[model samples]
Target: MTAFTAWQVWGRFVVNDSPSWTEPASVLMMGWFILLGSAVGVREGYHLGFDILVVVLPETPRRVLVTISDIAVTGFGGAMAWYGYQLAAGTWNNVSPALKIPVGISYTPLIVGGVLIVLFSLERILRRLAGLPEPHLEADPADSVA
Candidate 1:
């Protein structure tokens, strides 16, 4: 994607002949990157959240809240996957203006990433139920500065 952007910039400024395909291609690539990155964040328990409440809650309440949150995430991911499939299917016949590729291709990442989130969240929930240790996201204490 960076290569495409560089080529686009060089061609426009130096060669005076910018390629129309670069913009749309870069956008497609970025969309895939963001969707997949979000899935990875969920898998690693690195997604953004307000942890103050969870931290203050007692252990039992915290566990219940965590379980509820996980179930919600699982449901959301499932919905995304299902609706994304419908969206991709509906747009399969449509082509992009510049790239001329099927527009449905753009939605592929949503379906893939959503399914991955569902799997990862389900795994986390299972581990919690089985009394496995919860994954921690704390940074090393030594790494902190005064």
Candidate 2:
């Protein structure tokens, strides 16, 4: 996201005869996807949860359920990483208009975010197994519900 923004900024600079962007803007843009996913997690406490029945359960069961749910979520991330890589690799030749970069570059976020989700899920699972507190999967009081 930031990369795209930077691209636009650099594009303007190029037009205005200012210094051109030096660093690879795509890398910066890719970071935005990861940041976006993290923001989602932070906003919701966790991104993976069984929200349907959780509201009716007591805290204990709800925590246990969420922990269990995270395992599946992490596995899903793994699957996404695997499939996303294949998809990206398969479409690497296709280019975008603004960036003229490979279409696969956009999917980098999916791969990276999937890995991050897996790591977070593992952390949550370990915390659960170690009897540490499970992280909240709900938004803060002030945040709108997902």
Candidate 3:
């Protein structure tokens, strides 16, 4: 995305006319970036949440609430995968005008992100069940995969 954006800028400023594919490519890359980032956020529990209730709850109730929250996230991931599949399938035959790629390819990240979210949420739940430490809201930078 950055490369495309830079190319777009250089083209427009230096060449007077931008490459047609750069804008669309950057937009498509942005969609992928958001989806992938969101899935990783779920894995790291990095997304913002209203934590006042959980913070005030007793340990047991807080655990229960956390479990419920994880369940809800899993459900949301499932919905994303299902709906994304439908959307992608519906648009599979349509090609993007700028990139000449199947438009459906743009939506493929949703399915991937959804699956990742579900997996990560399930891991959290399983860890809780196993009496292991649950994932922290923010992962240690050194502990994260590159």
Q: TM-scores of all models?
A: 0.87, 0.60, 0.86
Candidate 2 to truth, TM = 0.60
Q: How many residue pairs clash in all the candidates, one count each? A: 0, 0, 0
Worst 10 residues of 2 by lDDT: 17-26
Error of 2 at 145 (Å): 20
Whole-model lDDT per candidate: 0.84, 0.68, 0.82
The digit string of per-residue lDDT tens for model 1 on 1-146 reads 99999999999999999999998899889988998898888787766543556666777777787778778888888998999999999999999889988999988888998999899889878987898876463344775678
Candidate 3: worst-modelled 10 consecutive residues by lDDT: 135-144
The residue pairs in collision within model 3 are none
Worst 10 residues of 1 by lDDT: 135-144
Q: Which portions of model 3 show Cα errors greater than 4 Å? A: 48-50, 135-146
Candidate 2 C-alpha lDDT tens digits along 1-146: 45555665776667653333323454546565564666368334556468867866887898778777887888887887788788789889997655568978767777777777777778777776787754464434676465
Residue lDDT tens for model 3, 1-146: 89999999999999999999999888888888888899898787765443556656676777788888889889998899888989999999999999999999888888888888899889878987887865463235786568
| Candidate No. with top TM-score | 1
Displacement of residue 99 (Cα, Å) in model 1 is: 1.8
